[model samples]
Target chain A: MVHAESSTFAEGLTKEEVYTQVLEQASALLEGERNWVCNLSNASSLLYHALLSLPRPSSGVNWCGFYVVDTINPSQLILGPFQGHVACQQIPLGKGVCGTAAKEGKTQVVEDVEKFPGHIACDSRSKSEIVVPILQAGKVVAIIDIDCAELAGFDEVDQKHLEGFARIIAEGSDF
Target chain B: MVHAESSTFAEGLTKEEVYTQVLEQASALLEGERNWVCNLSNASSLLYHALLSLPRPSSGVNWCGFYVVDTINPSQLILGPFQGHVACQQIPLGKGVCGTAAKEGKTQVVEDVEKFPGHIACDSRSKSEIVVPILQAGKVVAIIDIDCAELAGFDEVDQKHLEGFARIIAEGSDF
Candidate 1:
């Protein structure tokens, strides 16, 4: 699979088409690439570039990245490969959106960060966020974190697709 | 002071001018930002974007990122924030470009990764490499590592300027 092609997603593709392509691209990029660090690194870039190829109003995501449970300190999540501004390094379980998702073992779709209680403002420019936890053996091992500068940047379509994206990473990689 | 401006770099800027802008931008982004993770995260993106804005021939850097000395495993360097393909996660002290720079408390500039003995081939696309160790209190705390796809990608100009870039992060941020 040639994952490094210039045009991973064709122009004029519908939003859904773009996402399906992202999933296929994710699979191809992660195929036989089992190292957790390497997998997450590539996946983050894959999503970042995927969004960059999409049309405007759906393309300007400010950040796309991951936060993994720190094996050294299980009580916290440490920053992994990310695109966009600098992010919070460690988020305690149940603290911010990433933390809350990790603690609850679920996905968090924040239409606006300002309204989210106890939001950790790592980057003031991030107005919206979506976080999906990646589980291995029923234990949450990491969270796929994405942030956007626009309000209501994510919805059910994003939630559904990204959950699938995270699932591919969780099931395929050796976390 | 607005660091998010569209054209962060002015046109017709020399390589020296571009590096100076990078240094200044690092300061602006790090001002009052004490979190080492946040500082390094933004710094890596800043340099990545800075290189992208430079003249074409000077802007083909394949990777720009950091590797920190793993506190849990003091003898090893763990992957940190990066822009590029997936990289090797654990690099032992006194090994490879990043580890050698960390162990010796100096910079390692490799015109070719193939010729460097024991060079860990994390990203096969990275042909040239430069690793600058970040020191705090006479001890290497972390390293600023960059890779390029082209041969002899980095030179004395990058060395001197990036050493200064690493110094600002070390002295300005609370690691």
Candidate 2:
């Protein structure tokens, strides 16, 4: 019988502790399932709910999802599995935060989206954002995009953990 | 500039009216975007949020998502874009509510999931479900699955509207 597993973080855990749990859980979830779609879909849910389980700042996350490199148009990134509001369907490389991350093949952590030049406002309420490029064999395959309603919602802790998360996705999935 | 569009239903709309709006909005969101992943991602968010915007029974929705026929394993359905907790990664054709719809290429509206044999409980809180197969070229390509927390959450109206929603997805996406 198939069972529904809870993705919530345990009570009283620090943000780093919660993220540690998340990375472990994500690895376990992706163990034998190398399908990129499945892994990414579940990973987003796991990350979204884990963030929501925390108090402010982290809990201020309004959007958590992905944008994958378009197969037909290599210079663009298409929307992928997400746990948030409807978003832009396509973003070209080097255009916005997501596009910049994909084009530069590096993580873009914007303390204030308004301060970032060419930041694409996919969600008007998103004051801060983080985009982690998932690279495989030195090529950008996809990106993990997180939007927060609070300013400076993401810091180095998030950068380090999310980069680790991206590595897990890169090594776990077939993409 | 990429702008985030709201998918919320207008206030005080009846259930049928809300569904009508959902169908129209889904079409507009899907216009010119034939990618199945992007379309399904947005469609699931649209439907899930639309349902949540309504009053109880409708607002009791616990999950809404899609499962496409596996490209590698023809008889299995792989998890697709969704708006809910994490779900089962795979369901063999003819095994559960989602699988049955995929295998039969028909809609399955179960008033009480517990009463249905071979029901796979991806979410234990799901008391009811409606699964509509998206058929293309006379074969099943994907399924739109919705789960509700209330018993008998789905009726003929839901079946009809969701079938229409399935048709829109079938015709709009490349699969």
Top-DockQ candidate index? 2
Q: Write the per-residue lDDT of candidate 1 for residues B54-88, one digit (tens) a residue.
A: 76445778778888787767998776677765455
List where candidate 1 sits over 4 angstroms from the true fold.
A1-43, A50-62, A66-81, A85-157, A164-175, B1-3
- List where candidate 2 sits over 4 angstroms from the true fold: A1-3, B1-3
Which residue pairs in model 2 clash with each other? none
TM-scores, all models, native as reference: 0.68, 0.97
Q: Mind sharing the TM-score for model 2?
A: 0.97
> Would candidate 1 be rated incorrect, acceptable, medium or high by CAPRI criteria?
incorrect
Candidates 1 onward: DockQ, in order: 0.20, 0.67
Top-scoring candidate (lDDT): 2
